[model samples]
Target: MALPVACLFASVPVYAGEEDIYFSDLPMVASVSRLPQRLADAPTAVTVLDRAAIRASGARDLNDVFRLVPGFQTYPNNTDAARVTYHGLSDEDFSPRVQVLVDGRSLHSPLFRNGMNWALVPVALEDIERIEVVRGTNSASYGTNAFLGVINIITVDPSVVRGFSVSANHGNQGVRDYTLRQGGKLGEAGNFRFTYQQRDDDGLKDQFDWKDKFTSRLFDLRADFSLSERDVLEFSAGHVEAVTMRGRLAKSQNVLIGGNNPGWPIHDFSQSSTYLQAGLRHTLSVNSDIYVRYAYVSDWASDRYLNQSANPAYNYDEAGDQGVRHEFEIQHNFVPLDKMRLAWGGSWRNDAVRSDTVFRGMSWVSRDVFRLFGNLEIKPINWFTGNLGLSTEQDSLAGAHTSPRVSANFHITPENTLRIGYSRAYRTGSTVDYRANWWEGSSLNFRGNRDLQAEQMDTWELGYLGDWRGWRMSLDTRLFREKIPNRMIQVQNQVEYMVEVQKIQINGLEYQWKWQPFDTTRIQVSQSFIRIDSEFLDSALAGPLSGLSAVPRTNLDQLGERSAPRYSNSILLMQSLPFGFEFSIAGYWLDKMKWTRNSWQDRYSRGDVRLAYPFRWGPRGGELSYTVQSFEGNHGEFKSYGQPADRVVGRRHWLGLRLDF
Candidate 1:
C-alpha cells in the first residue's frame, strides 16, 4: 500500500491551470466549529466534497458518495434501509452514531432511530453545492448523535440557478428516474427555486422471499429574500413519499410451527416525510452576525404485514409508526478581540413518536431537549493557534450532560501544519432504544429499560496537512484512538433490548490525497487502516436470554471488533477527452467485515466508469452520458442473521440525458 502511494507522488510534470483547485492555506471551512476557518487552522480534520468531485464520482445517491471519504463505509440496501458509518460499530439496519445536517437543519430524528434516512432525503444531487464532513467526534458543538462524526450538506444559492432544467435516466433492473427544476426571480428582491423528481428501480435479485423493488417521489422548494441591507430571510420546504417491498417466506412448515413464529409474507412498506424551515440573519457589523432559525419535520411509515403459520392461532399483525419534531435556535458570531473569535448559540427541540407495532399499545411518547454551546479560537502568534469548545445539553430521556474539547495547531511552514486535539462526546439512546415495548406471542421481543445510561466516548488524535503547489498535490492524514467504556448493544432472544454490555477501544490511521496532474486530468485517493479491541461486561455474561450458556463470549467480542474492516481503499480519476467528451473511473476495495454479530460478509473489489458528451443546437444545450456500476461482477456486502445467503450485488448499466432550457 505504501509503495503504490509513494510511486503515485514520485514525479509529475509542472503544469497549472487558471481553474485548478488547490488546498488553500487560508481558513476555508464553515461546518466544523460553526465558523469559517482554514483547513490547517481548524480544530479537527475535515473532508470537502465539492460539486466537481461529486459529479465525477457518478454516484446516484448520497450514501454512495461517502465512499470517497477515508474511514467511511456504506452498503447498498434493497428492501431494508441503507447504513453508513465511520470507524464503525454499526447496527444491523440503522446507523445511529453519526449526525447529519442540511443547511443547518438536523436530519437526525425519531423517525429512523434518530438517524438520517438516505432513501428519503428530499434534496436532489444537482442542488447540492458541497458537502463538509468532520472526521471525528464533535459533541462539543452539535450535542448528542455527533458521537462518531458529522456531515453537513450545503445547497447552491438560488440566485445562481435561474432557468429551467430537465433530466432523465434509464437502465437495467427496471431503473427509471426523472427530474424537473425551475428557478426564477420571486420578486423585486427575492429568488426562488422549485423541483419535482421521481426515482424507481428493481431491488436485489435472487432473494429468498419476495422480489424486491423501490420507488420514491419528491418535491422541494426554496426562496431567499433580501429584507434589508442588514437582514436576510430564507425559507425552504420539501416532501417525499417512498414505497418498498419487504418480507421473506418460511423454509419449511415444520420449522415455522416449532418456532411458534411464522414466515413473513410479502408486503409493501410505505413512508412519507415532510419538513419546513426558515431562517433570518442580521449583520450587525463587518465582523459580527446573528441568526435565528426554526424547523418542523414529520415522518410516517406504514409497514403492515401478516405472519402465516401452520397453526391458525399463531397469526399476527404488524407495522405502523409515526414521528414528528420541532426545533428553534439562535446563534451569534463575533470577533471579540484583535486575535480572537467567539461563537455561541442555544437551541430547543421537541420530538414525539407514536407506534402500535413498535411500542405495542403506546399512543405517543415525547421528549424535549435543550442545548447551549460556545466555541472560541485564538491565534496569539503567526505560527500558533488554539481552540476551546463546550456544550451543555438537557434531555428529558437521558438527563443532562456536558461535552468539552481543546485543540492546538502549530504551523511548521507556510505549506504544512500539525495539530493535536482531545475531546469527549455522549450519545443518548434513541426513542426506540429507550421506549420500545415490542411483544410477540407470550414473550417480550424487545423492551426498553429506563435504567440504561447514555454512552460516552473519549477521543485523542494527531493530524497533519501538507500541500505541494509545484507538484499540484496535497495530503491530509490523521492518527486517532477512541475509547468507549460503556458501549451499548442490543441483545437477542427473550427480553431483547438495548444495553451497555462492553468496553471498546479503536485505533486507526487514515489519509486522503489529491492531485491535478494536468489541465484536464485529476486524481483523488484515500485509504484507512483500523484495529478494534473489546472487553465484555458482566451484564453481557448474564444476559436475559433463556439459554444463556448457548452463546459464546468469543462471538460477543467479535460483534464489536469486527464491525469495521481492517483496511479499505478508494481511487478515482477524471479526464477530459477529445471532441467535447469526458471520461471518469472509480474503484473501491474493502476487507471482510460484518454488519451484525451473527452475519458475515466477504471482502470485495468493485469498479465504476462513466463517459459523457455535451452538445448544443441553436439556443439549447444538453449532455448525454453512460454509466456502469459494479463492473467487476457479482459480489456481496451484507448478510442477514440466520439467513444462508448474503445480499449479492450485480452489474448495472444506465444512460442519462440532461437539457437546459
Candidate 2:
C-alpha cells in the first residue's frame, strides 16, 4: 500500500492502447455500485465487455467473450464441463465461487448446490447488450454468495430490437444451430420481442467414456410498457430444456421393477429450467425514483448418481432435487444533495428442494435469506471523490453477516485517475456442503457434517485508469491482494466432509490496453499474473482416522493454487478492408495451469480468426461470415485425460449467415 501510494503521488505515466471493443465504463454501469457512478470512481476494479467484443471474438459459446478480460480463464473442454472462472479460484467441475446473473436473475441451480449450469442458460449470445464484471470481491453490493466476483449480463432492450431477424450456423464437430427472433410494437401500447433457438453438438469424439454430447432448445420473451410519463413496466420469461450424456454406459444390468426387468441403457442427465421476472419503476420527484422487482425460477435435474441404487428404486427423480426459488426486491435511487447520490435496496429470497437421497428420510428442505444493501457516492471537489457501500445479510443456515467497501480516488486529470480501495466479503456454505447424505454402492459414501460454517476474506487493491490522448489509446492497470481465513474444500475418506481449514493469501497484477493508431486499424492486449500461498491450519485433524485412506486433500501442496494458471494474456487485431469486408484475428496464451495436487498442465496457446462481408440494402442489412478456431494448432488448457488431444482441443470451423428485416 505504501509503495503504490508513493507511485500514485509521483504521477507515474502509464502506457497502453485505448479502449477497443470493451472499456471499463463507470457511469454506464449499475452492477458495480448499484448507484450510477463514473467507472473512474467505482470502489473496485471493473471490466466491461461490449457487443463489439462479443461479435468480434467469433465465439460459438457466450463464455468465450471472457478471454479478453484481464483475470478470467476460458478452459477448453467438453461443453458440459467447460469453465469460465475468475481470479484463479477454479479447481474442478461446478465452479461455485463466483455469482452469475442475467438481467438480475441468478443462473445457479439449487439441485446442483448453486453451481452454474451453462448448458441450460436461457439467454442467447445475440441478445446480450453488455457484461459488467467486478474484478474483485463485491459482496457489499450483490449479497452473500457474491464472494470472489460477479458477472452481470444485461440483454438488449426490447425497444431497440426492431422487426424480424434470423440466423444459422453450421460447422465441424457435429455443430448445428438455428435461431429465429421477432420484435414489434404492440397495438398502440408498448413493445414485445421473442426468440427461439436450438443447438446440437457431439463433443470431442476421442473421449468416449464420458462423452460430451448434448442438444438443447430455448425460448424467451420480453415486453415493455410505458403506462404514463413517470411510470414504466417490464416483464420477461424464458425456458430451456436440454439432454446431455453423462457417466459410463452400463455393460450389463438385471434389475427388476414392478413385474418386469428394466433394461440398462445410456446414463444421460436431463435438465429443464423456467423463469419469470417483472419490474416496475415510478418517479416520485425530479431526483428520486423507486423500483420494485420480483422473480420466480424452477429447476429440475435427474441423475443416476443422485439416486440410491441399493434400494432398487425405479424412480430417478428421488435422487436429484426438484427445486424452486422465489425472490422479491425493492430499491430507491435519488440525489439527496447536489454533490451526493445514494442507492438503497432490500431483498428476500426463499429456496426449496425435494430429494430422497440427498436428505434421507426427509421429504424436502427449505431455507430463507434476507438482505439489505446501500451505496453512497460523494464528489466534494472536482479532483477528489469517495464511494462507500455496505450490505447485511441473514441466512437461515449461516446466521447473519455484513460486508463493507470503501474507496478514495484522486483525479490527477479527468482522463487519468488513481484509486485505492479495500473491502471485506463473506460467503456461506452451499446446501450440499451443509447437508449431504448420499450412498454410492456402499463403499463410497458422501456424508456431510451438520456443523459447517461460513468463510470470510479481505481484499485490497490499487488501481489506475488512463486515457492517453497523445498515443490515441487507453490503459487500465491494477494490483490486488486478498487474505482468507477459512477456505472451503472437500475431504473424502470413507465419508465426505466440507471443511474450511486453510488460511490463504493471494497477490495479483492486471493490465489492459486498447490502441486505435489509425481509423482503419485497431489492436488490443490484456494480461494478468497471480500468486497464491496457503497454510494448513488443522493438519492432524485432516489425516485418516484408522485404516481407510485419508482425505485426498491431506496431501495437498502449493502447486495447485485452485487450478488457476500463473499468468494469461490475449491479443486482438482488427482491420477494415475495402469492398465492405472486415478482417480480425485473436490469439490467447496461458501459463502452466494445475488442476489437482498431482496433475500439472503445461502451457498452451491458441488463436482464432473471423472474416465477414457486410452489406446494406435500403432499410435491411445482413452479414456473411466464416470463423476458424484453434488456428495455431492444438495445445492443452486443462489437465484431463483418457485420450491425448491437441491444445486439449481440435480445430473448428463455422460458416454463418444472418439477415434482418
Clashes of each: 4, 9
True lDDT of residue 572, candidate 1: 90
For model 2, how big is the CA root-mean-square deviation? 6.4
Candidate 2 lDDT, tens digit per residue, 566-607?
Answer: 899998888889997988999988887666454456788889
Candidate 1 global TM-score: 0.93
Residue 568 of candidate 1: its Cα lDDT? 94
CA error at residue 147 for candidate 2, angstroms: 0.8
Candidate 2, superposed: residue stretches over 4 Å from native: 1-27, 76-80, 249-266, 305-319, 441-444, 539-555, 558-562, 596-600, 641-647
TM-score of each: 0.93, 0.89
CA deviation > 4 Å runs, candidate 1: 1-27, 253-262, 310-319, 542-547, 550-552, 641-644
